[model samples]
Target: MSGPAPIHVVVVGSGLAGYGVLRELRKLAPDATLTLVTADDGHFYSKPALSTALAKGKHADTLVTTPAAKMAAQLRLDLRAGRGVEALDAGERVLLTTGGPIPYDKLVLAMGADPVKVTIEGEGATRARPVNNLDDYRAFRENLPNGARVLVMGGGLVGSEFANDLSGAGYKAVVVDMLSHPLAQLVPQQVGDAIRDALAAQGVEWHLGRKVVSLDRADAATIATLDDGTRIEADAVLSAVGLRPHIWLARDAGLETARGIKVDATGRTSDPHIYAIGDCAEYPRGLAAYVTPIMAAARAIAPSALGTPTEIRFPPLSVQVKTTAYPVVLLPAPIGVKGGWRKVSDGSDGLKYLFEDETGRTRGYVLTGSLCEERMDMDRSLSAAEAEREAA
Candidate 1:
């Protein structure tokens, strides 16, 4: 009997997730032909660098040089740029795109996510900006003048980091968030306090517990009006509230979506032959919009895509890892791991917060700076929590 024909895989989106899937497919199935389709200019680089671009004294072009064409050449694959997927016909195994229809033995949705848009009134409101991709960052870099006054419209991870970075670079930054504290939902109260203090020390202003009602464009400045009728002025405004997964294609294709393209633990979507990963996927356990989980999802899905029999599960620990200039490191308390925290300060440079369940079993931890010295040992011991309980 003849061997089956080599499988052809189509990966949508050219972000980290899509690139990751393609890289893994190359590793696992060298014989397979892979096609990467992207809507934007497919530049290969780390998205995390956006946070520190200004502080690093770098321009957006410095972030990436190898475009999709070069990456495809290096990987020996077909790359379609500026071609967004229109829909997916799962039953027929066809991918409908703006350019044309493409067939694939397997499909991976790594479409990534879009930055959330805020609703406000005023002239500047119509001109408000958001940075979702390298192009957007380039625009931001070009528009920023020396000592430009900037108003960030959120206090979440993206917002806080932007504030810190821009402020450190000598740009006047003010963060406005309706939340009680910075990174309130993502971090514990104590961690949030430390982050707020750090940013404050860097000359970043905060308008906690306030919402923007509207924005008006002045001759050379933008005026932002708060809900309480307070007004503030800035040269530019950035909205980093949150991200919405790019799920319109999946939804139009009749795939299920909940905050994102719903997928199982191994990145398998509702349609077994189709898979999703990275910021676009909502895993069975939870959605983790970070590079680490994306790598895990890619590794798990690659084998399955290649007709290999394998089962994979995400590590119990899921989180958004951030590398900040303060030299900050954090593994956000995992979802649904209810517990209390005990903090120990090694010095001004390090602080460790341990989360334990009622039984005193280590469930999660957050370490900053030098405190991360204990990370390896803590991770090893925490991994034993399951075996330790089973043995008990």
Candidate 2:
């Protein structure tokens, strides 16, 4: 006479979503068998800090707050690091990995996004570095010497942050982008100009309204040729164009996907037994890449996947830009809303603006400079429905 086997849960990722669900699941089902599988070393670090790390003088190993061994022991989990999923067998409720087949009663997919890849025709085309993880950041830091001239592609948030960080640390950072303004996709023109000016005052060279067409090696330095017929020489090159979710794995396994894996408010995918979260999940509005949304998803997923129905909550949260040269906090207006941003106030250090819709309703807002302290008050003024509708 043997007792019944414990329920097993398998998670395919080692990022915030995977660890988040496990931390919450342990609170609900302490005795449930838990396992975590990842292709990397499974070290825990703040992914957002990678852009601003140069000013703080943090190495790759220094960025890791906890290692795989510690996380597994603390949660009493079976940790499978340095392993990748070759294929997913949804019909049989099993995962095909490099090690072997792993059957599970429930599965969680927390696969994060990858940098959008673009090809450039040149000999040094292989020199474009994108730091999306600890290992990537480690290599980036090791390759650059103090005061080295670095060429940065894209004027988005990540790119701007890195430019500010590098310039603040005495690195000669030159930025090239097709957009005429900084953060053209996220912020208003006023805010974008403010970011550009602030970083420019910090020694960051800007080549806006232009893009690198090709990269070639020149002795010890790399030469980046611009479409505007300008060639910039630098010791290193970095790319931060955009991010794309990991949707192929789910799509190939016969799961619904659009932009990212489609999931309900409770984080449940097309298959009830499997749930998706983080950058890889597409909510009703869009993919919420910020921290607060993913934490809420994990909380609901832990209970919902364990036979309990729990809906995730999307509160009005403010996204703060980590650039030290300029301070920014914003909540973008909802998509398809007939609205325009109007400058409200100008302070000594920054400016404040509000997004008003056609009907004169306040839809969203962005605050810069000294007015950034009003973020919490402004954030609460917006409704949850409109706030959660932020662009992916």
* Residue-level lDDT tens digits of model 2 in 150-265: 99998998899899999988898899989988888778887888899889999999999998999999887999999988999999999988889998889999999999999998
lDDT of 1 by residue, 312-342 (tens): 5445453433435444455566567777777
Steric collisions counted per model: 0, 0
Candidate topping TM-score: 2
Which segments of model 2 are wrong by more than 4 Å?
1-3, 335-338, 383-392
Which ten residues in a row are the worst by lDDT in model 2?
Answer: 383-392
Q: All candidates' TM-scores?
A: 0.92, 0.95
lDDT assessment of candidate 1: 0.81
Clashes of 2: 0
